[model samples]
Target: MSDFVLTTPVVLTIFNRAHLAKRVFEEIRRAKPTKLYVIADGPRPNHPYDKERCLAARAVVEAVDWDCQVFKNYSDDNLGCGRRTASGLDWVFSMEEQAIIFDDDCLPHQTLFRFYQEMLDRYRGDDRIVSISGNNYRFSGQRLHYSYHFSRFPHLWGWATWRDVWQRYYDFKINLWPEIRDNNWLTDIFGLVQAEAGPSSEVFKTICRDEDIRYWSRKFNIIHKEMWNTWDYQFFFMCFLQNGLAVLPNVNLVSNIGFGDEATHTCSVTELANVPTEPMTFPVLHPPFMIADAFADAYMQLIFNRSC
Candidate 1:
């Protein structure tokens, strides 16, 4: 592979997963990025290893092998999931016009760096393209378009976006609860409600409903919410409300390797290894598509309940 320069900076949001955190840091180091934003979650009071893991995670970033600008947000107290992530992203947006955001669990292919560099430049001014994601799960069905497609979901695995879009984010489901319930937005956003919702659904949706920042995102009329999280189902809902689009690649550029039993969300036992490790080319085009209404319900019954 060849050296790739970033057109936009990269931001990494991490908690206390020291082992996976080390892998993420190493990937970035090998890619030789110019700038890196590290959002390290604070330790929980009375939690024995939380602080130690957080510090270990920080140490990995500090040991980046290349000449790079690193911004650290080592919180003094645990902010939990909502605040830690929301605040970390807020800080990243404040620093750069655009950034490729990552959570520690994700491991990028060697060429993902180059792919982002090219796509960020191509779609920077295009309001329709809200993000440049490292993961694309729809590669098999769709022929490769531009390495992404126009969707309503945010792929949290490893993704990129501009400050202009992030600035409009607010905790809509909370601050504007009346509007959300009145509009019946959650059902529409997530498609159909699941029969046996997973623990994370309640937690995730509760945050969406109660969190202040999320309410703001709903109210501000943000154009798109692109991410690599399996929660893309809900993301599709939020983005759909805004009438936004997502760019999905025909090739599976990104993969979720968080299937181990120790994982917070995905703890599947059946191992899926020996996958291809090549970066799909960019400028890939997407075909026409339709949103699956009951997709969320089926996913909950199939994936979340039995596995996670």
Candidate 2:
């Protein structure tokens, strides 16, 4: 890890959680990336306490002592989850060609910086690989010999992506979902999984079925209607739309500590809350080919079916 240098910019999205932001900032400070982009949503007018808390959270990033150019994108109005995240990334890519992203609650192992830097470099020109995620759901006991595997699901607890991928695929308003939905275009992406096989083996069929498809279809319709204050679903929709895969580490690299009353979305303690992180073994053993592990993807689908 000594040879690792995080030339890629780092994007940290924060809200009214000074304590959590401070903790995440410690790691960012440790990584000492050359460029740091901090995105903050303004305090909600209804929550009288939000102003002080939001300012405190924004203050933590000011402790940057290292040689770094810190960029701040602070909003005066409350944009909620969807608009804030989408617009933040938009501001980031507008300047950077690529960036490693973090929500203040998603703490990362030190190795994550190295992992993202390398993955982003390796797949920089590859359009089929949309994004790289730091989270490993750990749904199954099986382990892979490589450092990471391809996944259709890009978990955003901690993640990275190229500017081109985001600008081309993601839509904050989800304006195209209706067109895709009306034409039943989503089936073209996962249709093979519903068949006897897809990507590699029959397990894909076992894991992704009509029920799973319907679950996602329902999700698309819901997010398309803006039922939830989220931006990730639309990102995943773009991944499927372009037949792209995300690179997910073999082990969990991020632990979400942002659960409890202060959290907007993750307000309750769940299995995903504060999961442990393990450092990725460096000089990553790349899979001989780029293919989603069907068995693993199957388990991932099952977990979504159960959890969502």
Clashes of each: 37, 0
Q: Which ten residues in a row have the lowest lDDT in candidate 2?
A: 201-210
Candidate 1 residue-wise lDDT, 1-308, digit = tens: 55346546777777788788787778877777788888877888888988878787777777876788888887888776546766777788887888877778777786677667666766677666666665444323443233445444455567777777666643322334457656766554544343456766542332222332244335333322322222233333345556555444444455565567656555654423223445666444434553421332233233223332
Q: Which stretches of candidate 1 lie over 4 Å from their true place?
A: 1-3, 138-140, 143-146, 172-174, 185-237, 268-277, 282-308
* TM accuracy, model 2: 0.91
- lDDT per residue for candidate 2 within 104-174, as digits (tens), equals 99999999999899999999989889999988877775557888989888788889999999998788767
lDDT of residue 144 for candidate 2: 70
Please, what is the TM-score per model? 0.71, 0.91
